[model samples]
Target: MKKYLVQFKPFLIFIGTFFATYILLTLIYKSYLNHFESDDVDEITRIVGYNVDLLLHAFNSDVFIQKSVSNPWLEVWYNNDYVIRIVEGCNAVSVIILFISFVIAFSRKFKTTFLFILSGTLFIYILNIVRIALLAILLFRYPEKVHLFHGVLFPLMIYGVVFALWVFWVNKFSKYAK
Candidate 1:
């Protein structure tokens, strides 16, 4: 038993750290969300929606986002069409938390880990905004393919970037790389 425990110590530590960080960050985010009234969209989601609106407008696309009166989401209108809802899950905080947790679990030096987390979080946030904007445009053009665009392709794109980031971290930056 002791021999097996010693052999698996590193793996156990990685899993423990990953889950602990994930849970802590998720709880903090949830608490922040709880501060908002049920009918009101949380600040992060609103910010994402605002950014999406800005990005679309920058491209000379007709777009606007407004808080939904009846629900906790923002309605994204693109090209004078109702395209999608920007919800809390669309804010990408959850993805950032997951990225941070994995990075921490494989972390070595404090500065490197902190920098990676900061940069990675920013990258994910920006990518998500772009994703939302692109998704809005695509959905407006291909309303019949909502499932393919929203449910599959967009998710694949976000998660694919995350997976690529993880691979880069493990190969180039993580303690395991050494």
Candidate 2:
């Protein structure tokens, strides 16, 4: 028993830490998401995007305007200046995942582990951005599908990326491997 425990101690520590960090991140992420649901963060992102667009249009004279909708994410507009967009989505969670994955991958001391993790994180972030953009567009394009898009397909896609990344680490760089 003692011999087996010693053999697997490092793996156990790594898994324990990863799980703990994941849970803590999930909690913190939920809190941040909840805050945005309140309208403050949502409005701020929209206004910032709009203001930037306005400034761009001031010089270009191709400005546009936009407003928020029932979707509490962003308000975008485009015109002479440019286009302003408010983007909010797994932003906090994505940040949390990126940092966590980087740390864990670096811990493994593999030459390409961090790079793989970085690639995975970037992929997830891009996917998330597209997810939000698509959701907003879908809301405009097919109002009836909003429920299916937001409640089902959206989560399915993002979590699918996450799960893929998980498998990547386990199969390619797991500490448990002999």
- Give the TM-score of each candidate: 0.98, 0.57
Off by over 4 Å in 1: none
Q: Any runs in candidate 2 off by more than 4 Å, and if so which?
A: 1-11, 23-73, 76-89, 92-107
lDDT of 1 by residue, 52-112 (tens): 8888888899887898889999999887888999998999999999999999999998999
* Tens digits of lDDT, candidate 2, 1-178: 9999899987777767777767777787667567655644554345444544555455563434454555444454333222224555435345546446535732565556667666776776566656655555555557678669888998888877677677666666766333
Model 2 CA lDDT for position 113: 63
lDDT of 2 at 89: 46
How much lDDT does each candidate structure score?
Answer: 0.92, 0.58
Give Cα distance to truth, residue 95, candidate 2, Å. Answer: 7.4
Best by lDDT: 1
Lowest lDDT block of 10, candidate 1: 49-58
